[model samples]
Target: MTGAAAAIAALVDRRLTVAVAESLTGGLLVAELIGVPGASAAVLGGVVAYNTELKATVLGVDAYLLAEHGPVHPEVARQMADRVRSVLAVGGVPADIGLSTTGVAGPDPQGGQQPGVVFIGIAFGSTVTALRLDLSGDRQAIRTGVVSESLARLNEMLNEMLTGA
Candidate 1:
């Protein structure tokens, strides 16, 4: 199954919801979920932290970390995922999952990292993990891959967390 369909089904079946924080993929990751029907039953909301400052200011990525390692680092992705889960919460109601996308997708590299070097972060229950993806493509393709990989990571998490498979 597609990651969007799998995520929505698993999330809905388990009475859970998800939020996102994005950088390189922009809003594409969340947009994929929203495109699937009944996504509202599982998707809470998302944030696009496209700028370096916004990574810290908007999504709560540590300012020191951004300065020390820049926005494309795994820690940035992890923080984006871990913190966005709290940011989307309202009145003590928090989403059950968080996902993040951060990377370099460009004609020129950022933070000394090559193009298509991405880290997808996921925070589910008591666990938070980051997936490093070194891809080969133009800008759009890299971003597209990030979105697909992000959802697939979430799909894997759903399987492990819910289906034990």
Candidate 2:
């Protein structure tokens, strides 16, 4: 099994469900989680809001924030995480954890942010934390690295939470 699979299994064992809101990495993060066995128990759902409009309309991102910070900002990532958690609640999933990704992964930059710049947001219950990563790679490599690194960070967070570290 992959590291992502192991993480999902651990989350399931803790009876914690997870949800995702993705943009720059697309739905690759969700795809990775769902590829694991017994993911249905731990992964509640996910949203692929590739467009800024959908980030506002579907994920309930604030219009002003999107306009102010653009779609690739840390605030956008945080809102994406919160929105996905709320959406999952409506679906009766009520996930215990929410993960989100927003970034610029391209041959060109957007919103003045360079390619390989990413913000990962993690929400547990009502609290949310955002981490910025300046990565180096091509588009595909950057996306893959973001997905893997995000999961690894989640694992670290879980360990910290479990051990009260």
Candidate 3:
């Protein structure tokens, strides 16, 4: 199965819900999850916080952190992943998994970081992990890479949960 399909199946099997926060990849990450058949059983929703300010005001990322480290920092990804579960909560219950992407995907540098400097954050329960990726390509390629990596990482995390690894 494709990564998205596998991740969706695992989530449904475990009765887990997921929410997404996107910066560099925009809504592609959530789009990938929801594209799977029966994804509604596990995908709660997603937020596209492409604007740095929206990352703070909408998704509750720390403004001070964004100001200090910019949106490409790992902490920013962590907070986006951690808070999005709550931001997209339903009936006061947060999602079981929160995934986020933040980075520079462009032909130009951003926040003092070169293009393809990306971070993917995965949050489950009380644990949040950020994976740094130094991708190389054009804008679209980097964005697509982020989405692929996000799905792969999500599947890995779900597998780990199943095996208690």
Candidate 4:
């Protein structure tokens, strides 16, 4: 099983559910997790807000923040993470964790940020943090790298949270 799959398994054992929000990584983040068998029980849902404006409309990111810093900002990632968890909440299946990816992975820079600049926001329990990554590659490579790193970090975060470390 993939790292994301194993992480989902562990989360399920802990009775925790997860939701994802994506922009630069698109839907790949969720796709990676759901590919693992039994992930459906722990993986709540995901949203792909690739459009700069849709991040606010669909994920409830602050509109003024979008206009001020665009979609690539760290706070944007944080809000997307938190909002997706809330949006995907069901009566007994509330998402306990949120993961978000937002950045520029392209042949050109965006919002004055370099092309491979990425932010990964993860909310585990009551703590939420955005991690900045400066990747190196073409569009596809950067996106793939983001997926790999985000899932790895998520797995680590889940372990830390579960172990109370």
Best by TM-score: 3
Q: Which residue pairs overlap in candidate 2's backbone?
A: none
**Pairs clashing in candidate 4?**
none
TM-scores, one per candidate: 0.96, 0.95, 0.98, 0.95
Which ranges in model 3 have alpha carbons more than 4 Å from their true place? none
lDDT (0 to 1) per candidate: 0.90, 0.88, 0.96, 0.90
**What's the distance in Å from true for residue 152, model 1?**
1.0
Model 1's alpha-carbon lDDT is 0.90
lDDT (0-100) at residue 9 of candidate 3?
A: 95
Q: List the residue pairs that clash in candidate 3.
A: none
Please write out the lDDT profile of model 2 over residues 77-134, one tens digit for every residue.
8888877887877456577888999998987999899999999999997788889999
Question: What would the per-residue lDDT of candidate 3 be over residues 1-165, giving only the tens digit for each residue?
Answer: 988999999999999999999999989999999999999999999999999999999999999999999999999999999999999999999999999999999899999999999999999999998999999999999999999999999998889889999
Clashing pairs in 1: none
Highest lDDT model number: 3
> What are the RMSDs of all candidates, in order?
1.0, 1.2, 0.6, 1.3
